[model samples]
Target: MTGRPTTASAVLPAALRAWLGLIAVLAALTAVVIGIQYAGHSEAGRADRWFIDPTADSVRGTWRNVALATDFWGEPAGAALLVVAAVAGCLLLRHRRGAVLVVVGAALAVVATTLVKSVVGRTIHGADNLSYPSGHTAFATALAVAVALIATGRLGLGRAAGLSLVLGAALVAGAVMGWAQVALSAHYPTDVLGGWCTALTVVPLTAWAVDRAADSRRSDRS
Candidate 1:
């Protein structure tokens, strides 16, 4: 072996190390978002009030309808459908690893979002319970990322434009859902941001872990 790392370990470590940096950044952002909520910062309060008050009322016509329609993308049923579609697409393309990664990453994201929301204990005016991190936004963001990953893998090299378009559309759709949450007074701005940070943190780390586990399994077989 010439003192070199094995192929599985070498391949996994570089990607995992890069993801660690991203995960740390996202974790810090999530913390800051939640901290602002918990500290009762004026900025957070003002933003929430501004969005939920007159702004919500001002948009109560056609714009509100559009936002309401867009918000469906983040609903539990919609998110589940998106996840299933992404995983099924991967499987149809014979990207079994991608399918597994998407499923694991999305599931972890949901669990993490729920736990964070419980721990943060932030609430919206019309909501029944805590709402620090919006579960709908988290699910939508995770679904978007999962679909982007699968699309990028399928597109491969020499298709940068195609990959970019696919990912951009997915992200834009997720952003629309987040905006809709604010417009509907379902969550604060910080809540949406916190959900996105949690999704970004959870998905990549979950994918890295899944990749490492797959690589280890292959190495064992070899």
Candidate 2:
């Protein structure tokens, strides 16, 4: 009996299996964004008021301080610090691919959010600002997604374990930053949701692209 030779696609077939669910996730994100755009458009609508009425501009004391601190992580200086630390960790682990994924994923997520904001024309504080898909939330969530992906690869986690880690990290990061944005009255609740979904949509795709590129290079060398 003769056996077929394995090709690069066969070897890396599972590379994208981990993110199959993203198809559904991407659809859901799209639907939600469209709904928000139709109803909320350039300003907060009933749904935004429903979520923001109780939480927005109500934080105080220790909570306010915490929110401010969390908000800083999404800022340029704090984000740069985090990126440096993450890159350092990846290098220590000798996971050069992971380091690239972190940097590229974060950059892409932030850029995507900015571009969406301009097109969506959503604003919270004033007309001068664009707030749909809160950049801070997207940045924080992107970092979490990057860390989760790197950990998944380094630890050789199974699909279930990796998925759980990614989702959990994304949720925690998104919630923390989303809460901060709302508390600061910097964005509507829907904007935060958009940001979280944007990270989710961007990071995994980035990871898959990175994997494909690496695998292609390996095949070429072989």
Candidate 3:
């Protein structure tokens, strides 16, 4: 008897299957951003007024210098260098899967963020050009996830404490960038949240795909 034709869904890996919850969360967050934009609500404006206005003057002095430094870390060049360094480190350590995860995760996060921002058409604080998801926050969050994956995979830091330590540092760094974006009035709070959700969704999905690919290659070789 002839077999049924193969489909993408039929070949989906368990690893990817496990990440459906995260993907759902990302979708929900994206929906929230879109809904807010379409509803023509003033909630975002109110949030900006509450968060940005109070901090505007405060971020202008020494805080301005700090914000500038934080902003630099979130810049495209900085994010690229971070990913490059991470991938290089993974390669040096011979963690090929981890390296692949870092590269692919970063790329996916960037592309997803850009696409969502474009499609959602959400603006923040009068900026018409894509602001629903903060690019800086997304970059930082993706970099953090990549770094965490590398640390666990390469360094064998699989213990709960070790994982916590690595992940905690990354979270703190990402949080700082998100806070800076909000304080600088570059994004509303929802934008930062959406960016984080995007990263959380993309990185794990990319990691699952990387692992599945490696497994398939191994199976083929064997």
Residues 1-222, candidate 2: write the lDDT tens digits: 112212221211254344734543783477356545643355666777887774335588999899899999999999999999999998887777778888999999999888877777776666777888789998998899888777766666776776788789999999999999988888888788888888888777776677677767776767
Which has the greatest TM-score? 2
lDDT of 1 by residue, 69-159 (tens): 7777667776677778887877787776678867787778778878876666676553346777777777777667666655544544224
lDDT of 3 by residue, 1-222 (tens): 122212211122232344444554665567466545633332365655655563344367888788888888778787778888888977786667777777788788878878877767777555465686777887888778667655554444434644464447557866898888876777777778777777777776676666667667666666
lDDT score at residue 52, model 1, on the 0-100 scale: 57
> Sorted by TM-score, highest first, which candidate order results?
2, 3, 1
User: Which is better, 1 or 3, measured by lDDT?
Assistant: 3
Tell me, by lDDT, which candidate is best: 2
The reply for model 2, stretches above 4 Å from the true place, is 1-28, 35-42, 54-58
How many clashes show up in model 3? 0
**Residues forming the 10-long window of minimal summed lDDT in candidate 3:** 1-10
Candidate 1 overall lDDT versus native: 0.64
lDDT of every model, 2 decimals: 0.64, 0.76, 0.66
Listed per model in order, the count of residue pairs whose N, CA or C atoms clash below 3 Å is 0, 0, 0
Model 3 spans with C-alpha error above 4 angstroms: 1-50, 54-58, 125-127, 155-159, 162-170
